[model samples]
Target: MTMPQMPDSPGTARPFSAELWTAIDPVYAAILDHPFITGLVDGTLPHDAFRHFVVQDSHYLRDYARALAVCAARAPGEDDVRAFAGDAAGAIAAEQEMHAEFMDRLGGSAAQAAAQPVGPTTRAYTSYLLATVYGGSFLDGLAAVLPCYWIYARVGEALLAKSSPDPLYRRWIETYGDEAFQGVVRRVVALADRTGAAATPEQRAAAVEHFVTTSRYEWMFWDAAWRRETWPV
Candidate 1:
């Protein structure tokens, strides 16, 4: 379904257009449609595969924490913006802690896995996101990161629907499909719209670059996951 047009206001940015949504929707959909990721949600992915992802995700979250710190530093005086940064940071922390425990449970070491050079897809996506957050305007950074939120919500919802009687799947789905996680996506999208509304041509161009870059990277991430041996480390 198409996203509804957000109400326009002087402070509101251009609503996510059909064209832009069309561009991003496929990227988001690709992630949701990935068999490995889908299996993860359903607890059908082999334990080894799930454990590998847990390690990779732990690495990803470290970069995410740094990006959140940069965003917090760049945020303007708006309390909501600051709170959003804080929320991002908190999410990163929780992900890190949870993944660390999961790693231990699987007989892995967070430090070793983190120190290993990231896969090409992981490096590309996280580096681009961090660079955007530090080098671009706050709104532009939000645009770059917003896809992750959008994709997560979509994936989470799908997982929730496919959840089985398995306690593990139920726990995973519950954590991601909760209202709080959905709230994060809503707030970020709203922030993006607000930013887009006020953006200068240059700002809009930057945001678009981030949008495209992120979309492409999302596909690469899935591709790498599907073919781990061929994926660059």
Candidate 2:
């Protein structure tokens, strides 16, 4: 797909994250169509499903931090390193704070949370990420994980615009849709765009594949949550 030129900055004539967003718009459209998101927006989603997602997400965030650390270490500049490391810490804090609140409201305990096994979809997603960061280029890893930040911000904004009446659903939407979170997303996007612009064609293709695969995983995550997925014993 040809990336459209975005509005230029004061003296710069380069495209930013907007072009990348256009490239992935098809996958993104499918994500919005997923029942898990629509259900949340309409408040017809089963409480059990959202509860499952919160638990799975809490576990997922722990490993996500480790992956972020790997990316931070591989970052080309100190600023990128710091940005990624700060994001890692933020993920851990959100996992602790927000999940704790959800658990209190959704009938779960720390003991149960600690003991819960990783669901298959969550395991696959995180494992894919960890492997990517371990074996791939720094740019590849960044693209791989970009969806976690970018997708959430976009979905949050969309759902928040809908303004669900269910408090539980609303909280999730508001959290992701917060302007602060979008700022973080934009920072990551800028970093990725810069990196992409400097990449070789082969390198860019590899990064695009990583991005596409992870984007599909994001879709599966919501679908898995809706289905209340579990590992086979």
Tell me each candidate's RMSD, in Å, in order: 3.7, 3.5
| lDDT tens readout by residue for model 2, 1-233 | 11223677798745535555666889889999988899888999899999889889988899899999999999999999999999999999998888888888889865577578889999999999999999999998998889999899888887777978799889999999888998898889889889988988788778888888988899999889999998768
Q: Which ten residues in a row have the lowest lDDT in candidate 2?
A: 1-10
Worst 10-residue lDDT window for candidate 1 reads: 12-21
Clashing pairs in 1: 13-197
Shift of residue 226 alpha carbon in model 2, Å: 0.4
Clashes by residue pair, model 2: none
Output the number of the lDDT-best candidate. Answer: 2
- Give the residue spans of candidate 1 off by over 4 A: 1-14, 17-20, 164-166, 229-233
Give me the displacement of residue 198 in model 2, in angstroms: 1.0
- TM-scores vs. true structure, each candidate: 0.81, 0.92
**Model 2 segments beyond 4 Å from truth?**
1-19
lDDT of 1: 0.68
